[model samples]
Target: MPLDRAKTLQDTMTQWRHQLHANPEIAFQEFDTAKFVADQLKSFGIEVQLGLATTGVVGVLSKGEGDCIALRADMDALEITEQNTFAHASKNPGKMHACGHDGHTAMLLGAAKILAESGTFRGTVVFIFQPAEEIEGGAEVMVREGLFEKFPIQEIYGLHNWPSMPAGQMAVGPGAMMAACDTFDIVVKGRGGHAAMPHLVVDPILASAHIVTAVQSLVSRWVSPHDSCVVSITKIQGGDTYNVIPDEVVLKGTARWFSPELGCEIEQALRKIIEGVGKSMGCDIQLIYDARYPPTINTPIEAQVSADVMASLVGETNVNRNPIPSMGAEDFAFMLGKRPGCYGWLGAGQSEDCPKLHNPHYDFNDDLLSLGAAYWVALSEHRLI
Candidate 1:
């Protein structure tokens, strides 16, 4: 197997991942990151292209050209400071690769190097190093700027590191693998007055409190009980002083669902909650709902093929054929919307101490570097065969 040969590149891949982790950049600002990826691709004699989505990079390796397939890796980091005191900890103070994007980038680069050096596959492989996948919509921008139109690709694939699952396990499904992302900003406006005079003020904060509890009912009451969805209020901004009541409360959070109808329903439910509660509390309400990503749904044929390919290396027992889809959203859904593809999860969790994605103490497991590279190589060969 081509992927089996990637074992030799494990150390090299780990070095690359560590370097990327040290210097983290967020969103479309992956200038240094893109250059590094392009340089590595060019060093391997692969064709490199830049500036698709400002800082996105594409590397093409072609042999006899039986078919063309794409493998994507996100290159952006998050806006969190590094807590790990390791040597390769993030150099940037306010930015960190908390979501294992460094690992993702390194693994794909490893696969590219192996494929280029061996020339064992007869098809073309497009390596996509996408910028701004951490909450920003770099994938959507790439699609809008003619990513599929530029490359003659039939099938594309993507993967993310999974800290919740065991390191050797893999998961991919035919239906929704990730949910659609809808972010909302809500403002509850009320009269400001003395804190001690409870009856004198309308109290937007109290109204906001009721709103938080009311929206939770949307999932069980409005949407189907069985559908996978989420309504979370992550941030609340309102009061500045301790003794005075605030005039308004701002609620910021996200809504997630597998289907478009459910996404719409969630938004409608939020509006209803805000309006119904605002009217009863004598407060003005405004909501801004931005649908960022569609659900990452896998076509049946592509999902089956990718799952089978992954099982070849990781074993059938470790492959999760019926794993529950995550409520967290993935922007790769935009890419899949344009092409036939599958997105899988490469398990990186080792023990109970393993931190989940976006956590301050999180780090990409270097052990999965070679395994991920192997999966990419195996996927290309099996799909293009």
Candidate 2:
């Protein structure tokens, strides 16, 4: 019955999603996207609040005196160029909704329209349209701007489209759902000289290579075998000429872990490795490490509530109650930290070869729009009742 109610608006939601996909905006620059969302919420007769985190929008719908809950959806796109040949392909060059944020925004909007019209719940529902989820930490910005302080929201919920799972499936658990993300940069300084006479100068490139190999030990050797951690050197920049070695080599990379204590240990061990390698290679290496998003951990009760509601829509067998956590990071962790909440993954994959998130060829599955919207509505009604 819940899914049927949402299916009635699937066509309208798909149109909204396509419109948003065609005009993709990134980060805090979601001005047009914010206006579109505000216009929709106002048309639905819900109270709209704007200007939080610059482009964030909140739509409140209250029917009676009861608990207040918030459902969030990200609205920003990524910086990757589009590769799809569909009619809804991105119009903006070098910007696309490769991460399914358009689908997320549309689904939440659909749920808002249904809730506003039906008024099936007794309490208040807060619809949060967030921006800059790619890498700018927009959720953190919203929290710092006093999101919870302004609204008496007791619980929050967030959902993201997962490409690895089959369409219409759902996953939620009580522990960490996403890993903490941290970045580091190492600048190795050495003496530059001709490549032909390698003995005459200190090669920072060799030192950088050693640093990379040594940092892998941070996960394999330094961290426990039972625990999970990832250290990747994403960027390496050093020399321009083939005949000479540059004086400095800059290494940029990221570290991921679930526990805060493990995060600290990883950073400390990483700094020590860099310092030792620099000293051994006769180079001066400067390390700059920044801790970004924290692990997304869900409260037990809220996670159970989400799972129960999901089961009601698509049986318990379709729901994954104990799925493994992902290494990818989400800014929604900031909101979960501030309030009791749960973050879930809605499967969006259409086939085994479906393009993954952040890929240029990736597109959100429109068929899942109704299912996701229905899940949101069901959760709202279950919690409010």
Candidate 3:
């Protein structure tokens, strides 16, 4: 195919994207967005299911008897004010599709329309329009609600827009496309005393400074050189007055690693370092660790399937393998963990003028809409056939 039909699909998607971009909704509050998606799916004669994660919608299209494949797109906007001066800029104050989620939803909807019209594939294609991807774990909630069990999907696929890569290009890797994210808070308790009396009391602020320095050694000295990890102490709060030391000091930060085992090891090491340092300094310490998303590991077979489908649509030269893994996390890992699947990066463009993700000035590239739709359609037909 020459992707001619994809151009038509792109035109439809562009309108949908504009409407969505105009009426942006934040995580878990995508009621109108969900309704819009449901209505579109129903209009296309696809079976629709709603309310999996408050406002998530799933559309099912079946052609013949065979296994099923799932295509997912998140439908949540970020808590950012729109800085773009375009006519379709966000109307919702302090909410914008800076992550290109509007584009993702529109492209998936485009694929649904094409697949429903073509009716060339065997089995079913489940279109997942999920909510709350930026904050709460919507993907996690959907899996818990039996999304896969009800749909019985053999494989699932997700895609995100990458602004750094040139438009029309796609990137995929076999494993660890994104890192595991974990957050931590530490409170150090000590006696409060006047700053003038240096020996009178233990300063928790001093102890906290030591702990921060010690924690850095966990990644620098403990973790292997080849393995990737990040430990950043982003916040520290202690004394309010220069003359008096406070009774406690609080520290907040996050840890990231590419492997689950490595993440666990890092957590254990953090606890030991905090407690060991606090005890030695005659201060009590409390640590709170929250494990967020696990690393997104693409199964080999699924990765190959994604690469081949993308190559067929965009040509072999446009698909990239072995792209560097990102330290950031994605909730899509939850779905990929449950099923054999891969998540690929769709290039938006490579202009320095193009706004990066999460930036208020950023908008999903309308030019890539048809390209994404074509990839989705080709993947569905190829996999089902």
181-215 in candidate 1: lDDT tens per residue? 88999999999999999899999999999999988
Give a tens-digit lDDT track for model 2, residues 228-345: 8999999999999989999999999999999888988988899899999988999999999999999999999999999999999888998999899999999999999999999999
**Each candidate's TM vs. the true structure?**
0.96, 0.99, 0.97
The TM-score of predicted model 1 comes to: 0.96
Candidate that would win on lDDT: 2
Name the candidate, 1 or 3, with the larger lDDT value.
Answer: 1
TM-score, cand. 2: 0.99
Clashing pairs in 1: none
Please give the lDDT score for candidate 3: 0.91
Clash pairs detected, candidate 3: none
Clash count of each predicted structure: 0, 0, 0
Clashing pairs in 2: none
Worst 10 residues of 2 by lDDT: 259-268
Q: How accurate locally, in lDDT, is each candidate?
A: 0.91, 0.95, 0.91
